[model samples]
Structure formats: structure tokens, C-alpha cells
Target: MLMAMRYHIWTEGCQMNEADSAKLAAGLARLGYQEASRPEEADLAVVNTCVVRQKAEDRAISYLGYLRHLKEKRNPGMRIAVMGCLVGPRVDDLKARLPFVDIWARPQDFDAILRELVPENDLGGEFWPETFPEPRGPTAYVPVVHGCNKFCTYCIVPYRRGRERSRTIEDVRREVAYLCGRGVREVTLLGQTVEAYGKDLPDRPDLGDLMAAIHDTPGLLRIRFLTSYPKDMTEHIVRSVAELPKVCEYFNIPVQAGDNEVLARMRRGYTVEEYLEWVDRIRELVPGCAITTDVIVGFCGETEKQFQHTLDLLERVRFDKVHVAAYSPRPGTIAWRQMEDDVPHHEKMRRLHAVEAVQERIASEINAALVGTVQEVLVEGERGGKPFGRTRSNKLVHFPGEARPGELVQVRVTRASAWSLQGELVAAAAPAGS
Candidate 1:
């Protein structure tokens, strides 16, 4: 009897990359490949990487080094493939640098690796598998949009992933329906700038239209999208969230910096006043909605006063959550080529922690308000042997209950924390909009 060919995929970065990895794994499964727990045990070892931050890039490089050593010392015939942003647009440099890597597939280009691995087979036609592999869990990520057009000065996505492209509503709907059949109850429509979806299509339907198109998916209990651009977040999108029962009342709008000067330097294309107006509009339209944001601290030439502006903005907004990152220049980004990274390393850390501290207090206060309320949670899975899930507002809830994954349950908040809610199971509930 022949031994089964095993493959392993090690992934790093955003939810988009996670979705990409799942798609690739599904493709590999269709080609008669079983998953190996570790790289050493696999016939093919793939590394899906990210270069969004210097730290992320360092981690990818370090892992590749390990794989290189492993191949030379132990697994001489092990095939290694490198994918994602770290591979970039042109792989000649990366190919030369990581010569041991048998395949150098770009981000979301799974066919490149698949073709290389199964050269004897005629694996053509639609790259996506009709049925995803087993153990897909109750929740899954679906990438509606690919790449990005917004070339923010500090961002390397456009350079790495190329221009924006969107999947048609019909195409997205098919995937959602297929995922529903596979026992996925919740789906998060993903993109670098999720709200910018449909701009490139001929009909230009927009994100609101896309959500409405899939609102009636038979088994899908919830819908969500993320990483929105402030300018592209239209009233239509907010209203869609209010009108669509399945769509979660959560928005992840990234305001790279709070000060206008920093915003211009980052080429974010919006002012602090403009961003505030959008936030106010969202709150006015969607009651009890959870608004999250991303902030980059210590961008090129960011002064103490400018950093104080960011602190003030956080205090003013009192966002439900804040994702803060310290600035690290990427080689091809406009910021790296044109400006100086004048902020010291310690100063960057100080600013990053300052934002975290303020946001922590705000999140604690916001969650504290929900202590006596009951949140309808789609029980995703368990943590520490207790069922855990997320509310429509995207707040994590941990409850004491005998609930299986994919079941909807009402959880009465018993305790509140900054990151999650501790709850007691009140009753099982029907899917939302049922």
C-alpha cells in the first residue's frame, strides 16, 4: 500500500489570508492530499506569509530559514512553497533569496502552487472547490474583494497584491450558499477595503447591494464585513446594516492617524472632522452598533502634539474597540521612500501603549453597560470547555451551557470585561430573521 501524500500550510496575517489558506487547503484536498500536523511530516510544506509590518516580515523570514534547515538536515525531498505578500509582485528577488523554495506563489494565487505540486494531473477549470473539506467549523471567512486600489503612503498592499477587483454578487452568493450547506452559520465578507467592493464591476452595485443579495441565504445565520475606508462608508451601507437582520452591527473603520497633518502625510484622504461626522452618522443610524477602528502611532515625523491629537480623538470617539500599531516602514511604501522615520523606537512603543490604555478603559465602560442585558449569540465553539460565541454587535460572550456549535442561544450577561462578556445561558433561540 502506498503512503498518502500529506501537506501542511502555515499561515500568517489578516482574515483575507486565512480565507485564502482555506481555499488552497480545499484545492489540495481535492487533489488527494491529507493534512500533516507539522512541516517536517508533510510531502509539501507551504508558508503563507505577510509583510504588513516589520515584525511580521521578520517572522516569515525566520520561519523560512527554519524550513530551509529542516529540508537540508532531515527532509531532503520535502517540497517547500512560499505564498502571500512576502512573495510580492516579482518573485525573482525572493526566488534568488529563498532558492530552496520549490514554489513561489503570489498572494491569492493558489493555482500556481497547485499546478506545481500536481503536474501530472489536469487540474483545470474553476480553482475553487465545489465542496470545502470537513471540519470547516460554524464560522468561515469569504473574501468578496481581492487586492486594493487605495495606495496609502504607508501601505504596501497595492504594490504587493495589485489593483482592486470584486467578485460579482452572483458569485459571492454561490459561495455563501455552498458554505451554508457545509454547516457554516456565519460568514464575514472580507477585503482590504471591504466597503470599496463593486467599484470596479460594470454594474457598480456596492457593498450594500452585495449584503442584500445574500441576506436570504438559507442556512446562514449572520453576516459581517470589515476594514472599511472612512470615505467609502456610505449611508446606503449603514442603512443596509440597520435593515438586514442577519448583517451584524459592527464596522471596522481604520483611521490611520487622528491629526490632519498626519492624515495628509499618510494620504488617508479624510480629515478628523470628516471622520467624526461619519462616526456620528453611523451612531445616529444604527442604534447600539459596535464601532471599531485602527490607529497607527508614530508615523513619519509625528510630533508629541500630533500624537496628543490621536489621544484626544480616542477620548472623543470612545470607540467600542481600538486596534493600535506602531509605525514600521516597508521598503516600497511611499513613506519609506519619501519621508524619515524620525520617531524613536521607545517613543513608538509609548504612543502605542497610550492608545491601548485609553481604549481599554473605554471598552471596559462600554461592555459594563451590557451587564444586565441579554445578547443573542451564535454559539461558535467552546473555550475552556464552556460555550463561547459572539453577539450581532460582535462582542464575544462566554456562557455556561451545553450548546453545540452552530446553535443560536440567548445569553444573559452576568459579568463584563474589556475583551469579552461572561454570561449564563437563558434559552436556545431560532436563527435571526427566522
Candidate 2:
């Protein structure tokens, strides 16, 4: 028998963390646990941490400090468990810095954390039956694989989450079908290196085959995937997205640096020229596809010439959007061990702004072209007398409409900004309400 317990989960980091939290919530629910409306009233609290960057770790620690205060003053008996990228054996700071944490579960300690924190008689080996959180909305993240095989010099994911391991194509199809059956219209296949999905599995079905399996899932209106590696992005995968009816025309392929020298230093196999060729191919294959990327400025010893190359790439590529970050050090990454953190803080900021400025200009120009066109948007929510959603291309569109989250509506793009589109509903659609 399970005791009456309520848990509050504090999630941090990427979509992988969010999916893990959803799975954790589902397990807790199966163990007869309810969610606490407030952290102070919870019997158990889980801090899902992220150590991708120094700032993420600091943010988690800050929240844990406050949670510790809550536990000491109002809920001393409450069980506190910390899990995710920041709690693994490699990390050495949690014990001294935040001693109030009752249990520390490493990145792979999913069942152990739940069993100890939930106080159950037996959690039997089978944890996959009621394996997910209830699908409450239109969009859900289904992680196709866990961890990264690529140990990019500045990256901490491989160190934190371990090597690449993929869910079988059958398992992935089952989960996607489950989500769609419960009113989830859109599913983004998640992974640290999602492009590397299905490599470890015995049958060796690639991402295209996995998508083909899920493309016909009933009630599924749209599908997407993220964080693709440039080198592994095959012509077949691009063809799959282009030809598949349900797949959205959005590709989030990251090219960390534009200079070949910098890319080589970072251990990214593909050169800048090769990356540009891939971009050209995606655009040629999937016209009007929303191609987005990530850029890290001032990595270790990157020079002014390399930074200019990045700007030139931005000008040449003109991506739909760019996720820009200034370089930051981590404890065990190759950059930390082998290279100098030679880029000064202020210089890093300057390079970051320069990169952003280039992308912002490119995005604004690209978005500006969307004016006077009709876009099919998935209504996500409303604010200020307008509903907001994303186009199949993943551009955020804010429009005047009566539709709520989950409905697909047509909107005429009346205005455009660098980051979002402003429009008015052109067709009425029934909302897929909660």
C-alpha cells in the first residue's frame, strides 16, 4: 500500500529534462502520489537539475536553497531529492553547497529516485505500462534517444548523460500513438543528438523509418524533431520531412561555429562549407522550411577573423532564427581540460551581441517576406485579445482569433517582426480545448 503523499517537481534545462519530468510524474501518479499545489505543502520535492552551463547549475542551486528553507521551517519531514545532469557522480558540489538535499539521484537513476522518494512496497521491474504523463495539451515531447555520443569540446551532455542509446522503433511508435490518441496533435521527437537516433538499436532503422512508422498515427496532426547534427543529416531524412504529410517543415540544425578551424577545435566533424551545402540541400528539398541554428561565440580561443566568418555565414545563410550563447566553462569538458578560456568575459559579450545582431537582421528580413501570406497556425494560447500559435514552419504567430490551444487555423500575416508574426484569423476552426 502507498501512503498519501504529494510531490512538487521543479524542472530545469531542455526538452529531455521536461520529458523525464513527465515520466517521473507518471511514475509518482502510479505510486498513488498527487501533485502539490504549493511547494510548502508537499511531502516530497524533486529538483530536476541541469548542468549544461555554469549558470544552469547556479540557478538550480539557488532554487534548492529556497526549497531547503521551506523544508526546515514548514516541512522538515518532507523528502527532498535532486536528480538530472547536475547530480551525477562526476559532480562534487552538492553535498557541501546544499546539504539539505536528502537524496541525490544521478542522471540515470530514474527508478531508484522514485522508489526511495515515493515509499512504495514494490515498484516491480516493469515501469513502462503507464509510462507517461497524461496528455493534457496539443503538444508533447517524446524523446527518441537519450544522451550524446559526440563529445564536443565545449559540451557537457556526453559527460552528464552518457553515450547514445535509442528506444526501439516499436517503443517510439507506441508512445507517439499513445500521445496522439489522447488529443496530442503535435509531437517533437527529442534527444541530445536526435539526428543520431536509432544507431545503437539492433535492427538499425534510421530516423526516417521511425517517422514513417509514426506519420500515420491517428489524431496526430503534426510532427517535428530537434537538435540535429549536420554531418548525420542524410538526404533521406530531409526527403522524409519534405515528403511526409504530417511532418512539420522545421529543421533545428546547429552549426556551432562558422570557421573550419573553430569547428575542428570543437570536434564537430563537418566543415563550414559542408554545413552550408546541407543548408542548401534542405532549402532546395523543403522550400520555405524554417531552418534554425545555434551559435556559440568566443569559444576558448576563437579569434576576430573566426567571429567575422560566423557573421558572414549568418549573412549568407539568413536562418529563420538563431539561438545564440556566449561561451561558458564547465568542469569536465575538453575545453576546460585542454584549452584556455582565453576569450575575456566582456569580449564574449561583444561577440554574442554581434552574432545576435547579424541573426536578428537576417530573421527580420526573412520574416518580413512573410507579410501578406496566409499561414496555417496551431493555436497555442491567447494574450491581449489575440490568440498565438506556431506555423508549420515553427514561426510564432500572434493573431486575433476565437480559437484556443490545439486548433489549427489559417491566419493572414499582416505584420512581421524578427521573432514573431502578427496576423488576423482568416478561417474559423474548432478549438481542441482541455
Candidate 3:
């Protein structure tokens, strides 16, 4: 009997990318491919690439180039596939540049490509999955929708990802039940703008309704969603999060610019006041929730005064984490076409550092306040002779203890830092009430 074709998949970029990878992996397994521990042992390799940032895109391309050498050295017959945003937007260009790539697929067709890679003889054939398969993992990323309706000027997501298409609540529930049955503890509801989930769907059951249904699912410990648009962060979702016990308090909302004019140029829809109001609502609903965000330091036409406004917003928001990105002009973004990339590299760097410094100061203060308080941490793993976990707010808390991944524990924070917290184990795998 022929040995199972070994498959190795390397995922890069967002949670969405990870989710897409899992789907592809599951689809491959159904097609009789087994997971390969080492890339060299694999008959097929898939690189799930990201294009959210210029650096990320550059890294993915560089990785593919490196993989070419790996293919020649190890499995000379190994078929290499590149998926995700990298290929979705530029499949033609990718095929033209890297002719060695056997399968180039988008997020939509990732599973089909993986399923088609089973036969060594058919490695060179074009591939794409005809049916979407529910994926299995300890944690699952359930994308409630695909694509972005919001075309932020600086972002390629709307253009490259196409239009929003939300899955029905029933479809999501079916996937969630499958994941739960597989012992998955966490399910992160995903979308380009998750808040806008179900708007385009025929049934039109809003995100809140979807969340309530998912939250009611058995065996799922944590329910979270991400990358919300401030414009669509409706009152209903806020109330749903506040009321739902299983729903996590952590929210990752990106307010690109603080100044209304800068936000206008970026096409972020909501004003500074509106953004703050959304934050206020979240805080009011979910007190002590760890709020994180994305901030772009220097967009085109950003003056020192506008930059100061950003700093002011940072001071007010006091985000637990800020994914700061300095603006880079991409090939075909609206910002690139209409606005000049006027901000010098040095200036952008300077502003980026400045914002980071402010974030450090704020986080330090927040962490300091937690000294001597016990917080429930979901144990992730051990590192450097210590076990580390995250609080309900997603704050990293480290303590010396013998605990396994996916276990919950309470830690009495003894020390705090801007980036992390040190604590003592108070309890292991205890209930929220206890």
C-alpha cells in the first residue's frame, strides 16, 4: 500500500488566515493526506500568506522564495501551494513570477487545492475545493462572513477581499457544534468587519442573535470576535456582550486616526467623538475589559496638530494593546491613488515610537493597579520554567505552576510590567463563581 502523502501547512497573518488554514487542513485530511511534522518530510506544502501590511506581504513572498530551495533540497517532488490574501489578490502575478508553484489559490478555494494534492501524479494539476468542509481544532475560527464592505482608503482588504458575504446563523451553529464535539474550548467568530455580520444575508439575523446562539452552545468555554468597525458596533451587540457570560470582554477595534479630517481621508466613516462613544459603551457594558486597537501614525497630509490629536485619543482610550502601523503606500489602495505618501519614513518612525511610548506608560499603570488582585487566567502553556496564561480581559499573567493548556486558573498578581504581568497561583481550573 502507498504511504499517506504527508502535508505541512505554514500559516501567516491574521486569525482569519489561521481559520482558512484549518479548513484547508481538514479538507486535505478528508482526501487521505496526513499531517507532516517536518516540512522536509512532506509530499506537499502550503504557505498561507498575509497581505495586511507591506512587511507581512514581503515576508510571505520571501518565505515562498526560500521554500523553493527547501523543495529542491528535501522533497524534490513536493508540490508547493500558496494561498490566502497573497494569492487571492494577485494569483496571476504570482503564477507569472513563481512558475514553480503548483497550486495558487484564494481563501475561498484553499480546501479544494489541499484536497486535490493527494495523488503524487496529479501534483502538477490545477486545484481548488468544490465543497467547504467544517474544520476541527482545539480552538476554531468561525468566520460569520467573508469580505469587507468598508473600503478604508489605506486598506487593500476591501479591494482584494471583494464584497461581504455573511454565512447564515444555521451554518455557523453547525460548524460551532462540530468544533465543540471535537473538544474545542474556544470559538472566535471572524469577519473583515464582524460587527456587520448578517447585513447582506437573506435571513438577516444580526450578530447579536448569532452570538446568543453560539454562546448557548455546550462545551465552548470562550466566544470572541474581532477587528470590529466602530461604525457598526451597534447597541444590541454591546448589550449581548455585556449580558453573555461566555462571551469574552476583549475587543480588537481599529481606530486608524484620531483627527476627524485624518479619519475622513482614511475613509474610516466614524468621527473621533463617535469612536470614543463606542469605547465608552463597551466600558460601561463590560467593565475591566481589555480594550486593544490599531493605530496608523502618519497617513498622507497628517500635520503635527493632527498627530497630537492621535496622541490625545490614545491618552483617552488608554488601550491595553495598540497594534501600531506606520502608513505604507500599497499598489492599488484608494489612499495611494488620491493621497500623496507625504510622511517621511523618519517622521513616521518617530511618531510610531512616540505612540508606543505612551502605550507603554498607560499599560504599566494598568498593570500596576492589578498588583495583589486575583485574576482568572486561561492557562495557555509553560515557558522559561513558568506557566503563563491570560485573564478574562486577555491580559497575560505569568505564575509558577503546573498547569496544562486550555485550563483556567486564578493568579494573584505580584508584579506588573508594561507588556506582561507576574503572579502567584491561587487556584487551578476553578469555576468563575469560585
Identify the leading candidate in terms of TM-score. 1
lDDT for 333 in candidate 3 is 84
Compared with the true structure, all predictions reach lDDT values of 0.90, 0.86, 0.83
Off by over 4 Å in 3: 118-138, 429-434
Across 245-322, the per-residue lDDT of candidate 3 in tens digits comes to: 888888999998889999999988889999998899889988888889999988999999999999999999999989
> What are the candidates' C-alpha RMSDs?
1.9, 2.3, 3.3
The TM-scores of all predictions, comma-separated, are 0.97, 0.95, 0.92
Per-residue accuracy of model 2 over 110-137 as CA lDDT, tens digit each = 7867767544356544443447667757
Q: What is the Cα-based lDDT of residue 149 in candidate 3? A: 83
Please name the candidate that would achieve the greatest lDDT relative to the true structure. Answer: 1
How good is model 3 by TM-score? 0.92
What order do candidates take by TM-score, descending?
Answer: 1, 2, 3
**Which model is ahead, 1 or 2, in terms of TM-score?**
1
| Model 3: worst 10 consecutive residues (lDDT sum) | 129-138
TM-score of 1: 0.97
